[model samples]
Target: MNKIATIDTRLWQLGIMAILLLLGVLKRDFSLLPSQIALTFISGLLTQTLFIKFLNIKKYSFLSTIITCFGLCLLLRSANLWVHPVVAYLAIASKFTLRPFGKHLFNPANLGVILGISFFPETWITSGQWGADLTTALWLIAAGFFVARNAQRLDITAYFLMCYAGIFIIIRILWYGYPLAVFFHQFQNGALLLFAFFMISDPMTIPHKRIGRFIHAILVAVLAYIWQYWLYWNQGIIWGLFFATFLVPLWNILFLAPAYQWQPLSGDSNV
Candidate 1:
């Protein structure tokens, strides 16, 4: 019997994200022009290539760079063309420069989005851009499930979602006496689902051990809840993840596990 082939999880994620980007652009009006998207890919890949050559890394994998570009296309918005490429370049650059204990400190796409929004006021994420439609929410959840499952970090996604939802229920529905519809409305945000599944569930940035991942997920949920609800802030998940990243090294120290590699046994396994 011929053995079935396994697709690289990064490719699976890339395909899924590409579909999401197409849907966002076609149906949701994601506010990005084709030129901007093209520029982002060009700059990101070019930067990745330069880094690999400069650093003398033997393995050349563009999957992560493509994935990061897709993420930037989906989540980031800016009026200027330069903004996308600059952010993309910085995002890829962080992966090389920000390593500690043999691992990248921040999720590339997350870091890019956070930095874009922070440095340039015009660039921001539209959490509700996908709308409150149940159909859209279901579509994201289904696609995200496969990606998370393939990455073997579905547990982190589940824990984060459950904790985030639990906090929403207690604070908004029960304590504040908001209508059930309000809770459901918030639950159906496509951006929230995207963050939970794609961004936070990134194996490279997440804790290696199961227990550490669980704790990390819960911490992000609580911090995000407080940031969005109590502090009346926008892009709560992005900021929450940013601040929570400070604790990841600590978690790794407390509970050691092998660093994640996109492809095992490859010469260039780090990507």
Candidate 2:
């Protein structure tokens, strides 16, 4: 196979997520506990394995579980240890159970974040885990853009960023008296970059067609803006993606395309 088709993009995701977790723990003073991290992986792995066996699904693989575990460790913070494992379990379980139109409706990590924040009072998301440092922001954008490019989902990432930044500029900057620096500062947020590159770029959950992906990105941006700006709520992006997930089936219906499937690398037997 050509090098492009030989690459496993999920490996890049895992490596980057591991780096983020390490950075958060060592530099950002994240509240993520060791026990929580351990349990999160164990729960996700076991859940994925069980579902694969019982459901007779030979198509799914373990990289998605590992990626989800890393995402949980990076984005989720909880005072309670059990919250991590439970959310991890449900997130993986949702992949098997929540298939609408033969495709998973929500990104597993995204769903895990939603569950943690919604069901557990002590759980929360930490944008500060990656921090607003200039170097860090640049690194995040560069790394994420590279990953999205390799996965051929750079269009969706670009569209989402453009729509989100445009909304901020037109409404919050040009319309109001806010400085352009404010816009730049908000883009420095790590959570937004992570969501754009990793969660939304997942081939399994997003739309299969180009136009559908474009519209989906717009929906996510608009819904997130409504939640944060109009409704006066925090973590709008997370909730925005959650509500937007319901319409994925609609996108598939309107667009009439096959669901995305991972193209396994050459000389690799796992499917």
Candidate 3:
């Protein structure tokens, strides 16, 4: 396979931008395009300089900018809040401020959402938590499966989902009366599916080893469930991802160190 086609780092980004746009359109959050475009340009420029470092046609840059705009639109629409452009600028700026070398500790969008929700209460921002209906839940589940397959992380996803569901179920059985409808509603609500598939699976920030990834993913799931149901934390996914981002990398390093120091077996050589 040609490396360029397969390894064009921008392709996944482009795909994600398109996804964000489609989400915006479906949810009718067209107004956020400008900010999304601006953010996309910054993301592209920084990612290209650090990772791909490739110079493409001018049109590509333009399209990339548009992608950011569309994403911002989706984000703002989803939030259903009225944050100013300055706030958006601050959110994007924080991405760089929070990570000096551009290795973001958490998803920028997740961070921005949480910051907006927590510190900027005056912004009047509400997430399109409204768009989170039964149909969207079904779609999110399908997308989650596909994303997990692409990342070769279906095992992790399964472990995480099972842990989350199991904990919630046990909690209901043991303490709270499990309202079946609300229980299911939680799964189908907000951008939980999006976080599970896309944000949580960011390769740069997640564990690489199979076992490590599984354990890390399970932890994320358990933590997410606790935050959402037990704590009633609104930005539950962000909290989960933020912790997973730091902890999973450490877990991978610790687990892999033992293997790295061990000599390979006579017949079975593996890292």
| C-alpha lDDT of all candidate models, in order | 0.86, 0.84, 0.52
- List candidate 1 stretches off by more than 4 Å: 1-5, 264-268
lDDT of 2 by residue, 49-139 (tens): 8987897865566888899999989889999989999999999899888877766788999999998999897989876566677888899
Per-residue alpha-carbon lDDT of candidate 3 for residues 180-262, written as tens digits (9 for 90 to 100): 76668767864666566555654444565777877887777777777866788755556776676667546665666232111
Candidate 2 accuracy as lDDT: 0.84
Give the best candidate by lDDT. Answer: 1
Task: Report the poorest 10 consecutive residues by lDDT, candidate 2.
Answer: 262-271
Pairs in clash, predicted candidate 2: none
Better of 2 and 3 by TM-score: 2
Error of 2 at 234 (Å): 0.5
**Candidate 2, superposed: residue stretches over 4 Å from native:** 1-5, 266-271
Candidate 3 segments exceeding 4 Å error: 1-17, 26-104, 115-130, 257-271
Name the better of 1 and 2 by lDDT: 1
lDDT of 1 by residue, 1-271 (tens): 1121145677777888998899889989889899989999999999999999999988768888998999999999998889999999999999999999877899999999999999976887888899999998998899887776665655899999999999888988999999999988988999999898888988889898899998999899888988988899988888888889889999999998877666542334575
